[model samples]
Target: SQQGEEDPQALSIQEGENATMNCSYKTSINNLQWYRQNSGRGLVHLILIRSNEREKHSGRLRVTLDTSKKSSSLLITASRAADTASYFCATDDIYNQGGKLIFGQGTELSVKP
Candidate 1:
């Protein structure tokens, strides 16, 4: 079963603007992570927030998690053309032995220069 589901299926913005994306999950997770992918390449981990943590930040990326609501949000500040990519949220199944990450549908972002 799919765990994460992202909102705003696609986003378009100008360089320097802020971009925000959201994800909602269905089950209890050990940890939630956000990743970015450019074109058809591999995903690069942006940030990971544990179930005990509410918020986390790294560079221009900020993430907030609400376990009570089973949701998470990602914010990208000072967006640039290079920020154009597909953003996905993943959740680690608490019941899985291998700690597999179930990915979201993803939000495709287009930052125009």
Candidate 2:
């Protein structure tokens, strides 16, 4: 069963603008991770936030997790056209064996130059 679902199915913005996406899940999770996929390519890991962590950042990417709310958000700062891609949130359910990740539907982001 799918654990996470992304919001705002799609988004578009100009270069240098920030992009924000959200994800909500159904159950307790060990960790939540964000990934980006370029057109016709595989997804790339962006960041991972543990259940105990409230927020994390790497480069221009910021991620926040609210376990109480079973939700998370990703923010990209000073976005570029190259940043255009589909973003997905994945969850590692605490009850699941083998630590499998259930991916969200994803949000398609388009950055116009």
Candidate 3:
């Protein structure tokens, strides 16, 4: 079962704009984490908000979680071209052995200068 699915597989915007992405999951989770991947590099942890938490902010990023609906949202305020990268959502499912993380296909964000 898929844990997360991000809307708008791809997005293009100018620098200094806001980007929003949504994710929906099938099962309950302990925590949901968002990550940013640059080109071909590994995923870098952006933020982790627990299921009990409603929202979290890190630098220019804001994330919201609604466990009732099994969904989450990510907001990037004042985006920059440097922020251009693929964003993924991962869920920490308690049922899996060793707690595997299921990632979304990802939203490819392109921030133009």
Candidate 4:
């Protein structure tokens, strides 16, 4: 599985500001998804936007995909301290049409009040 890179490896923002994390991949991909992980906890599925889809939304989470650039971005609006976590972008579980996801390093967000 190939891995992508995320920008702003670590981000510290205010409670109300918006946080944006970007991920760029290397090869072709079918689907792109974003997940959140709280400290000492399992990953929580946030949103999944297909390669064909340009943007998607789930509650306060917004995701955008740019196939031409092989990049995607996760935007969290009205951030809160509880939203402080590591966000990662992953590719479809289509390892040669198998079931395996390729994930990026991640963007560590720290929301402070």
Candidate 5:
């Protein structure tokens, strides 16, 4: 079951601006991943962090996870209209051995040009 709950169900920002999204989840997780989807299409993997890691970055994307708080956040810098998409956080339950990921409701981001 998806236990993660994303903040700001939707967001609107202008080009060159910065967008931030947050996610909170219940229970312990082995790893957490951030994904982006455009126009209801396939998910594009953004970044992933293991329980032992505090933060990870890829391109203009930055992800931070604090296991002690059971929360994580995604930050996008210099946003563009093309960056408009829905972002979701998935978690690999530590107790679930099947490797199933539980997803959050998602944060819809709109970057206006």
Candidate 6:
């Protein structure tokens, strides 16, 4: 399966700081998306950038893609305790005739007050 994998498994940061995570995947994809899950909450779409794009940003969240290396990166600026949650990357092959998403193991983020 063409699934993305997040590194560091876990991360801890202070409030007002920045949090960064990395994701790598196998196979080619039409686009990649980042989602956030807050503890018991469901995953919420953070952002999505197509393969043709190099970088994208939403509010405090920034995402970058490098298709050549089959990797992507996420950066969250001005982190807060509320930012404590899990971050995951999902790969979608929109042009694969069928729309399917492959999710990663996710990185647990912890923000301190």
How does model 5 fare in lDDT? Answer: 0.94
Alpha carbon lDDT at 85, candidate 1: 100
Clashing pairs in 1: none
Looking at candidate 3, what is the lDDT of residue 83? Answer: 95
Off by over 4 Å in 3: none
lDDT of each: 0.94, 0.93, 0.91, 0.89, 0.94, 0.90
What lDDT, from 0 to 1, does candidate 2 have? 0.93
All models, RMSD in angstroms: 1.1, 1.1, 1.4, 1.5, 1.1, 1.5
Task: State the displacement of the C-alpha of residue 27, model 1, in Å, after optimal TM-score superposition.
Answer: 0.6
Question: Any idea what lDDT model 6 has?
Answer: 0.90
Error of 2 at 105 (Å): 0.4
Model 3 agreement with the true structure over 1-113: per-residue lDDT tens digits: 66589998999998989999888888878889999999979999999998889999999999999999899999999999899999999998767634789999899999999
For candidate 1, lDDT tens digit of each residue in 11-33? 99999999999999998888999
Worst 10 residues of 3 by lDDT: 91-100
Candidate 5 local lDDT, 36-109, one digit each (tens)? 99999999988999989998989999999999999999999999899999999999889974488899999999
TM-score list, all predictions: 0.96, 0.95, 0.94, 0.93, 0.95, 0.93
Q: Candidate 4 overall Cα lDDT vs. reference?
A: 0.89
What is residue 71's positional error in candidate 6, in angstroms? 0.5
Residues 1-113, model 6: lDDT tens digits? 53788987999989999999999988788999999999768999999989999999999999999999999999999998988999999998655624788989999999999
1 versus 3: better TM-score goes to: 1
Quote the lDDT for 87 in model 4: 91
Per-prediction tally of clashes: 0, 0, 0, 0, 0, 0
